[model samples]
Target: MDYQIARHNMVENQVRTNKVTDPLVIAAMEEVPRELFLPEAKRGVAYVDEDIAVGGGRYAMEPMVIARLMQCAEIAETDVALIIGAGYGYGAALLSRVAETVVAVESDKDMTASAEATFQSANYDNVIVVEGDLAAGYPNQAPYNVIVFDGAVTEVPAGVLEQVSEGGRLLAVVRAEGKVGIARLYERENGVIGHRDLFDANIPYLPGFEPTESFVF
Candidate 1:
């Protein structure tokens, strides 16, 4: 299969048509070889419109959703970004093309190993895949210009939001169990963070971000 053509189609038919207009985001999506991020068996469906499983109960996220999230972040050439639960490193690779550096945090050991190998082979050196608690947000590299949750999350930890530098942005698909998800863009301004809903999405929940249960007395 001609991945180039398939990628182009994905960008045109799936992403661009869905209101993802950022030129840099589009360029990055087009340049990255997404198939390389997946297991060989899954590579055949790399450019498909839906999310694909990448092990440890995480999904790579749909292309349109990923592109919209990146677009909402408004990534810059010199920005330092962080991606939480970046399964298979596809989102990291896409962000690496537009940001100066990207810290991809994944809790699964095997997934991290595979992602690192994929990044190395693809020469996406700007992205650093680290194995750790996904909700912790890789605090060692705090003050990120862009923080992206590669999948749906029920809530954003305050500590994680604190990692965004003043004037930076955080993007995520916020959803509760048995409900529709909303893509949100959060911005830190003057040390205060606020968010606005961008769009609706229903991607899989990240492993550690499931909503907590409440009791009724």
Candidate 2:
């Protein structure tokens, strides 16, 4: 399979056509070898317009979703970004090229191990892969300039929000009422958060973010 051609099509048809015009984001997506993130059997489908499963019932978001989220974040070269669900560290690698540092969090131990190996193999020194619960964002490296939830979630975990610095930005595909939309949230000065729905999208649901039941009085 011509991975380069597929990546080009993904950038042109999936990303640019969908209004993801950030040059840095486009270049990062084009340069990142997505095939390296997927299992050997699924490498051929790395550039396809679909989610590639990365175990633990989670999946890498499709190219359009990733591009849209990156565009929304407006990643800066000096920004410190946190990527939830690192998978095989593809997103982290992409962000590392644009951001000053990328702290990628993965809940699954196996996935974290794989990501660490991939990072070492690729000689990526800026990406830090940590294994922990997805709902609990990495606070030790708190006050991130940008926070990216790599998969869909029913709600933005409060712990994750606490990790964002004031005026920081967060991008995630939020699932509600069986519909998924890319939601952008910003931290405000008054210790509050504001959110805006960017666009509808389909992304794999992240573990530990399922909605809990409530009893009516």
Candidate 3:
């Protein structure tokens, strides 16, 4: 397959057409070889419009959703980012270009290993893949200038928010209401965390981030 062409089309059609107008985000998305982050067999569908499973019940979110999150984060060149649930590291790769450093945490050992190999092969020296509990976040690299949840979650845990430095930004897809989910952008201000709903997205939820049941028989 002509991956370069497919990457370009994904950027133009799936991403740009969907209101992801940030030039920095667009350029980073266009440059990352997304197919490399997928399992060899799954690479065939890397640029598809929907999310694809990356093993252990985790998924790499749809390109448009990823692009929107990137735009919302407003990653600065000097920023250090933390990516929760870094599926196959595609999101980290994209963010690495926009942000100075990235710490991607993944709970699945296999996925973490693959992501590390992929990042190394791609020469993404600034992006580090760390094995850890996704919900716990990677606090050892605390005080991130930007934090992004790579998959949908029920809520942004306080632990994660506490890691964001003052004036830093965070973006996540929160499972909301009965229908579509809400894409939220959070900012740290005066030692407080505030968020704005940027858009609605229905990306697949990261396994452990789902909301708990109210009752069980």
Candidate 4:
């Protein structure tokens, strides 16, 4: 399928045109084989400008959305990252390339095992895929310099926000009013986290991370 060409097009067209100008992200996205994270049957559409479903209600986020989030996160070469809802580990792979280390938290054991296998196959040695609750974040590796949610969420849990290191960054597609989500970036400084709405994004919600319903009177 000339995947190299497809990857190039994805970066030059889908990503760059969408305000994702970080060279590290552009280079990482260009090199990482997106199809490797998808089921064999779905590899053909890996470069398409759409979210690729993996399984268990999780999806590999659309290329442009991911790229823009990464750019907004402002990843540093020495930063340690935590990826929530790792899914097929595509985002972890990309994060590993930009950051020094990436710890991916996933709820399903089978998915974690599969993600580990894919990481090994792809030689993503800086990534660790572990089975854990997506909403809980990976506190064992707490104080991460960067934390990224792989899908949209109604709100970022406080517990999850507490794990970011002082001066760290967190990026997510936060569900907003009008049934839409906004790509938001948060920075922690002086023990306080500040967020900025980056752009609008429509992505799948992470399984089990949805906010609990509140009864309306």
Clashing pairs in 2: none
Instruction: In model 2, state the lDDT of residue 148.
Output: 92
lDDT of 4 by residue, 25-102 (tens): 999999899888887878999999999887777788999988888888889999999999988888999998899999
Report lDDT (Cα) of residue 154, candidate 4. Answer: 89
lDDT of 1 by residue, 37-70 (tens): 8888898999999999866687878999999889
Residue 110 alpha-carbon offset, candidate 3, angstroms: 0.5
- Candidates' C-alpha lDDT: 0.91, 0.84, 0.91, 0.89
Instruction: Tell me the number of clashing residue pairs for each predicted model.
Output: 0, 0, 0, 0
The residue-by-residue lDDT of candidate 2 on 1-217, one tens digit each, is 8888888888888788888888999999888889888878778788878888866687888888888788888888989999998887888888998999999999888889888999889888999999988888899889898999888888888878888887788888888646655565555456788888888787778777765666899
Clashing residue pairs in candidate 3, if any? Answer: none
Clashing pairs in 4: none
What are the candidates' C-alpha RMSDs?
1.1, 1.9, 1.2, 1.4
Q: Each prediction's TM-score against the native?
A: 0.97, 0.93, 0.97, 0.95
- Model 4, residue 23: C-alpha shift (Å): 1.0
1-217 in candidate 3: lDDT tens per residue? 9999999999988998998899999999889999999999899999999999877888889999989898888889999999999988999999999999999999989889999998887799999999999888999999999999998998988988999999999999999546688999999999999999988899888988887767767
Tell me the spans in candidate 2 whose CA falls farther than 4 Å from its real position.
213-217
Worst 10 residues of 4 by lDDT: 205-214
